[model samples]
Target: MSLRDRLTEDLKLAMKARDQLRMDVIRMIKAAVLNKEVEVKKDLDDAEMSRIMTTMIKQRKESVEQYEKGNRVELAAKERQEISIIEAYLPRALSQDQLAEIVDSVVRETQAASLKEMGTVMKAVMAKLAGAPVDGKLVSDLVRARLQ
Candidate 1:
């Protein structure tokens, strides 16, 4: 089934189960997807939907960090819960070792010999990992370490 269908089904289940957190998270996701569709004038594919969810996760992570820094532990915990809920619909994340291996391979494939070629390497690595959950910051760090 498409991601949209899965989200709809999950939403229904959440409602029936009286899962307030899940229900809110799913509605937030649907709203985000709908807003993107309106902005682009087209329905998003699974890849696009995953990308949106990934972005949402990233935003929540930032919020968690900010909340923690501000000594708001409860808010940070709430953000983390939302992150976990959002991640449930995404593909399994790549392990750090796996991500490093991909970065190494891409570096060799692109013959990225120096930091100057970092952008090229980053682009290639991201393309290779497309539709899979990855941390861009981690990838960048790995590529920088590998190229140096």
Candidate 2:
């Protein structure tokens, strides 16, 4: 089944099971997609939807960090829960080793011998991993270390 279909089904299950948190997250996702579709005047494909969910997860992670810094442990915990729910809809994240290997290969392919070429290498690496969920920060660090 497609991701949209899965979300619909899960939303139904959440409603039936009285899973308020799951219900809230799924509705938030639908709303985000709907808003984007309205803005772009087109329906988003699965890949686009995946990107939206990934962005949502990234935002939640940043919120968690801020909440922790403010000593709002409860809010941070809630954001973490939301993050876990959102992640369930995305592709599995690449392992650190897997991402490092990809970065290394891209570096070799592009002959990015120095930090000056880091931008080119980063673009190539992100393109290579386009369909899979990855942390941009991690990718940057890997490329930086590899170039160094």
- For model 1, what is the C-alpha lDDT against the true structure? 0.96
lDDT of 1 by residue, 52-85 (tens): 9999999999999999999999999999999999
Q: Once model 1 is optimally superposed onto the true structure by TM-score, how far is the C-alpha of residue 108 displaced, in angstroms? A: 1.2
Please, what is the TM-score per model?
A: 0.96, 0.96
lDDT of 2 by residue, 17-121 (tens): 999999999999999999999999998888889889999999999999999999999999999999999999998899999999999999989988999999999
**Candidate 2 all-Cα RMSD:** 1.0
Model 2: how far residue 39 lies from native, Å? 1.9
Off by over 4 Å in 1: none
Name the 10 consecutive residues with the lowest summed lDDT in model 2. Answer: 128-137
Q: What is the lDDT of residue 76 in candidate 1?
A: 97
